[model samples]
Target: MSDEHEHQHEMPATHEHQMGSSLSMAVAATLHCLTGCAIGEIAGLMIATAAGLGNGWSVVISIGLSFLFGYSLSTLPLVKVGVAPLAALSVVLAADTLSIAAMEVTDNLVMVLVPGAMNAGLVNVVFWVGMMISLTAAFLVAVPVNRWLLSRGKGHALTHEFHGMAAAESGWRRWLPSLPTGALVSVLIAFMLGGLVVSIADEAGWQHSSSAAATTRPAQDNPAALALR
Candidate 1:
């Protein structure tokens, strides 16, 4: 009877551990997705700004790149293990599309709502501040989405099986067992890239401003406009 009672007590502990593991995995998966989306979005916005594109075009580019990077990042690991390209793509799409879409929508909406954020030059502090806040909001919004999908064995849960298989085959299961570490690394890399892009954009903005000022005549210096007044 003691043994039976001990086993019963252990069962609840096992169940709780599994639940905790699932939640942690879900958070890791969501973070990974957010990192990819943030990298793509930032890169796209930087390019569009450099090219003098309008907000509409910038948003189009940002959304396109977000999906591309998000899908590619998630799919690459599967493909590396000899999964068929089509199957890998499908799995990535199934696992990450909703999460990516939700993040992008929330981020873009925040950017648009932030006064002058969409129009602010890269050198402007408002632009970077708004981007940071929007990304944070998007992360918060995506977490519950990932958790819900994970609970249903969808979203990132679909990819967990592949991760397990790959880890087992490559003997990485023992060394780097947790997915959260990998996810954190990805997020760090993305932020670093974003900072680099912002630096480049700031330098470019300064050059552009200087060149424009050097070539364009001041309004007060235009005698023809003065005569009309």
Candidate 2:
């Protein structure tokens, strides 16, 4: 055989790696999408605030940016690996967008509906504290749901197909196990619980408008807190 023929014969037809059932892979892929979405949502929220945008606009912009960035982040990783960038991008967009969007709705609605959460002002102790708690909770809920999906290969199927990098070996995967999914679930739970209490308070004629209404307030600087304050 000629040298060209020999070279072609050496490569395997398809690499057989372990991916669980399609359903499992689908779940994992969906979770990876959520991971991207959560990161984007939080980043957008921070960026909008840092820019001194108001609440309603900030959330709208943040959620919008979050979706874009989330999709890009998810796609880029797969592209950087061996997959065709276009195909990888398509798969990620297809698998994760809706699911993450649903989660975002659940997440942001809870934040906005939490009585005076939006209007607590940047300096309002309750508002700032509540945001921190909310972001933390979002992270907490996302991680395990992500990991469980990841383990089964459903959440990240498109990502898993690429040879550019190993999913489980990447920085994202490395940090996942120790992270806080519980805290987010708890915070959301608390928000619901507090809502019930607030409803009761209202029903009993003990309810009053919260001192803080949800407003899109500008941010102020705190050297000690860095951009965080």
Model 1, 140-162: lDDT tens digits are 89988988898899999887777
Query: Per-model C-alpha lDDT, please?
Result: 0.82, 0.56
Task: TM-score each candidate.
Answer: 0.71, 0.47
Residue pairs with clashing backbones, model 1: none
In candidate 1, what residue range of length 10 has the lowest lDDT sum? Answer: 171-180
lDDT of 2 at 39: 56
Q: Can you tell me which runs of candidate 1 are displaced by over 4 Å?
A: 1-15, 166-229
Candidate 2 structure quality by residue, lDDT tens digits, 1-229? 6988876765443222333344344444444445555556556666666787778776887678768856776666565444566887788776556556665666677678777866544334445455545554555555545545555554554355464454455644344332233453455457545645554555455323332222212332335555664
Per-model root-mean-square deviation over C-alphas: 7.5, 17.0
Highest lDDT against the true fold, candidate: 1
- The TM-score of candidate 1 is 0.71
What lDDT is reached at residue 112 by model 2? 84
Q: What's the true lDDT of residue 176 in model 2? A: 31
Q: What's the number of clashes in each of the models?
A: 0, 23
